[model samples]
Target: MEDINTPSTTGLMDRPAGPDYRLGAIPLAPERFSTWKERLAQWRALRDAPLYLEDGRARAARGAERHAKRRLSVHHATQYGHVFSNKRIPRDVQAAAMGRFEADLIALTPRRVLVLEVKNWSGQLKVAGDRWVQVQRSGAEVTHPNLLAHNREKLRALHRYLAHAGVNIPAERFHQAVIFVNPRLEIDPAIADHPAVLCMDDVGDVLGSGTSLGRHMAARLVQLLTDAETNATLAENLLKVIPPTEVAAATAAIKGLRTWDRLTLRGGRELQGDIIWLRLTGNQAPAAALKPGGAASLEWRRGVIGGIQWVLRNRGAGNLRGDIFWDQHLVPGRRVPLDADDCVYFHEPGEPKPSIIALSHVERLQIG
Candidate 1:
């Protein structure tokens, strides 16, 4: 709960008051980096770069000590397009949308905080509701998430965390909001039972509340986490809500097929049999055929079949310019021949690496 005396929280919504919503960040360090795997990875990334700069034959190189620097982090970028897409956004753009919320909370520096997940969608945002739509300047369309429901879920998590912290807070202080960035995109409006959301146009101004904790409080909670005992207790309690990540969640998600045991390929195959650690040799093309309501087929040029994707068909031909992967290994769903060997591996993103079944034999197929 928030009072006039209570510190404000970080809000990720857009601001109209001032465009300067830039925030300062505190760095995060891993618990430990001495693992052998980490060391090997670090070595591989730096192995080819020149170690010592060329200078005079003697110890003259020492004069350029200021030039010494640490290796740059090898970034891994994931383009988030699954939720929704439009011309305003590119297919490969990475949204630090969550980061916006995180930074805002950091500035708020509250003893307890609330996170409201809001979506400003017009259509019924439920299974049996109307479809919400967002029209970009280019006349392209996108959908907003069910922000009202999302905020409620977030509030629950925040309350759980706050209680465990022993930092007593109340429900009223936390809020949620979903705003249509532009008001011109009209829609029939409605309300919900929750008090967290604020439906508006360009919520950025309200989110960047221009509130900040002084240096002392901000720095104090910067690296705060639930104490060890609290964390352990939370771990046990969380098992009840969402099943553990290992096998439970996956099994529960799939319709009737539970991946209790591993899937083994019975048919005879060569080096391409193993699903993980596959060496892909295939031609990547700007062309491939697919049905209007079906998955786009991407042809592998060579080697063991690797992977396939259902891409946005907007490339060369009329319907088949999407980036679809045709892998050799049998990925659960339907199995069809990619080459004389590989097949399609159908899966939604974020599935754990399929167990690596022990592969046998050297080779039977012609592996390039």
Candidate 2:
């Protein structure tokens, strides 16, 4: 817990000493995921096949090379698409190509491989244009396969070099891709038949395909990509649960703290202890109804563009109006008494409240 010194709010009774807040820190472990963790640990162990002569050194060099190439590829991609025509190769273009080049050179990858090539270009494609072309809907043209061809040749060259150094991988298993990064792009008919080229939308599907290389191999691949012992191990260990959705699923369990809670409101006050209801209105501001425990307090902050003027309850019956504030920044939890501009009220389900669309989704507090 910490203190917020908003002392200027009336130097009396230490105003901001209301709530104790702390970030949630949950310790996640592979043991929590049941059988998945063990299964992956076994897979990762297989990646250290000890097939290469200088296994450690080879992995490091390959990772560094790949990282450099990726950097260049991204840089160059930024400069593409314009009428530059690859003239002197703009600085960004050079960077993007370099990244691609490095990606081609890195051979310390695990089993599940994704060969990605990115391109940015605009111009109507055709059924045939020099080396590559393709037909499109509405009878338009696309770009040539020349760009793809160049990338393929480069990849093959790098592959050959690595193979001679003792690494052996089949062509089909390697995977090849030509990415069209440009939002506005056209593919020529020739490129259509080119097994390497793929549209952007399908890229994720393609990358996610295959056996996932289990857990062991994925870790080694991460190692090869990062060129470090710790990162590789960390990436490997995380495979137990894989993260992202897992994190969401794990944390969402906490929301159940208030799942079965209930509350009701009438007029401008609350009848239920757990829930609070009140009506408030003012001259020039947005009106809001709040239940003390349920709807919480009016969260309108001072100096803010808009202010919540009042809390609303069963309207036509009471026409309730009370409390108003002109400011920005809500108090913690928007807590406020009934008198000040920031007051709270409550309402029973389906009760006549404000027509504000957002009011329907309000969270009610729990009180037994």
Candidate 3:
């Protein structure tokens, strides 16, 4: 295997054929000249046109903003790579309030959901309640919208939206922070120790340290957020209501679900199943799992069908067959035969304890 960390001088095709060579060469390098020429011409046209100067400036500003966002994303990924991050959540999907209310970044772990409001403004700033007073380089005092308040509202909206969608995430598990992209920006001491606020330099100390949420909780949170069906549902719903322009702006920032093994479970339990549903309790439970009059918990499941057989092992004295249900129904339940193509639902009502079945009437086991 090639050492990815080490730089290679030779191109894939130029390297000598050997057991180490794994990639095949593509013959399209020569064809890319025309595409490059076209891009160069367009760049020259934009540079030469006086009428397009403003457009160029606007494009440059947008490019800088995107670069800053990308840098911040990379930094956070380094600090909390196990966490799931969604950037530029649309106003409608977040708060559904009037005017613009986009969240710059939203990160989720099993322990908490971090809402980060990113600002590139360069100056000294002071936080007062729900407002930020900025002193510009020109010594001019200016007031900008308070990111702390905005992020809090975004978190509130997210919790509400999740609840309405049947994906319960608690308000307490949601955290808010402001990330000043400008390194030179000085923050007032009054807000320096605020738990919700984070400077560009404080990310490593806050997220990477064990003093806050531990790595185990962070990993679990990431797993819940990256669950295939749940992520798809949330994305689909958000895209349905958000504006096209907002979608376009956020497209690059939205990350895909992280991959894991088919039967991977929390606490590193490797069980056999196409779908493994984990009923989490206490602090391990997801925000959605917090139910009234009960300890907060979350049921997380993920996997694809096939290659794994479903069965019911009878612990009773005699052999027997019984009906299987896709979901636990109040009635007798859906009757699914052992040989059917439908999914089998396994219920462990008393979790942390194994379910007892009669020896004669237990699930049959088969590999294929």
Candidate 4:
């Protein structure tokens, strides 16, 4: 929620409108997932507990944000301006029928503002008329909301919001895109080549292009800044239009959005952290003992073995390995705890090194 010009404020709009102010890179949050004491306690608790690898939808969403952040930072357009993530959707904008939402990423440059929706969905996907279908690696088909259409609506809402805020930019200057950041994702012919639907790899080309799609975008953004048209000036104008209290209100609403993985211990104690490394060595249920139905039929319980693994393995996963984040800072490396078996490394905010936890004592790990 920190602004590019100042980390103390929630939004860039909170700053005074100035013609010469500049914007800096707004990187992802830093390390220090848990307090030192909390990390020690988690380590001690896991000394004898079992580990269970669980996943959740929230975790995927958070990962997608990270992917988009990295991609945007390295792209050519980044030099033009900083990309903002989780830009809170104004209540007026939401009331105007954009629905309750937060922009996944907002690319603001001198000439244009690009609203991006980041999707981390993997596996095979296709379009079915108005609906989107997800063909899991297990061959089970799932229908998803029409995110493509929704993103367009969001762009429209943003245009309206900017107009109401008195920023007299053309509606054409605003753009929207749905970026699929997952490397494992496979798109059907229906949407694979859609202009607004892009893969992470295409981000650079799109941002740097001066063709029909970006003729008015990239070229305009690359133009030298004017004394009357600095990045801070536009940003300030946008902010100045909004009431000083508006930024605080929006930040409060979206600030505590928790995306960390949750660890629910057998003792009913829940801990928030990240699973750095994990191995699924638990015995699989016998063919006869396996549930008849898919994920729905499986009993999702804490400390139970194989339920999550079965689903992931069906989707071509042999084991689970993920980044560890403290607070929102991604932990470095994926190295396993030396000489550990049937154990996974866990990290909490403030913890420097990952703690080794036995797989037997862990009830379940809900990925954030």
lDDT of each: 0.26, 0.33, 0.38, 0.51
For residue 340, model 3's alpha carbon misses the true position, in angstroms, by 61
Model 4 accuracy (lDDT, Cα): 0.51
lDDT (10s digit) by residue, model 4, range 1-368:
45565555576655333221111321222123334444333333334343333356656677778878877866655554556666545536436453334678876543356779898888899998899999877888999877778887767766666656545555656677889887788898788878888888887644543223243343334333434345334434542221212223323333333235555544444555555654333322222221211111111212223323323332111222333222212323331121112444567656775665544344445554
The estimated TM-scores of all candidates read 0.26, 0.27, 0.38, 0.45
Runs of candidate 1 exceeding 4 Å displacement: 1-146, 161-173, 192-346, 349-368
Candidate RMSDs in order: 25.9, 27.5, 24.4, 21.8
* lDDT: the better of candidates 2 and 3: 3
lDDT (Cα, tens digit) per residue for candidate 1, span 38-141: 43332332222122223232122122111110000110100100011100111111432431111011001121132323232332322224444455456666
User: Which should have the higher TM-score, number 1 or number 2?
Assistant: 2
* lDDT, candidate 3, 1-368, per-residue tens: 48766545555544322221111221121121234344333233222322102244334434544654555456533333223332323345545354233455555433345666666666798975667899977899888777667678877765554444445444555567776656777888776667767766675443332312343344334436667455434433432211222222223233421111122122222222211221211012122222211211112111111111111121111111221111323324322222111121222322543321111111232110
Q: Which of 3 and 4 is ahead in lDDT?
A: 4
lDDT by residue (190-256, candidate 2, tens digit) is 6655666666555434343222435545554555566444543455356531222212221232111
- How many backbone clashes can be found in candidate 1? 26
Report the error of model 1 at residue 244, Å. Answer: 30
Alpha-carbon deviation at 53 in model 1, angstroms? 43
* Candidate 4 Cα RMSD (Å): 21.8
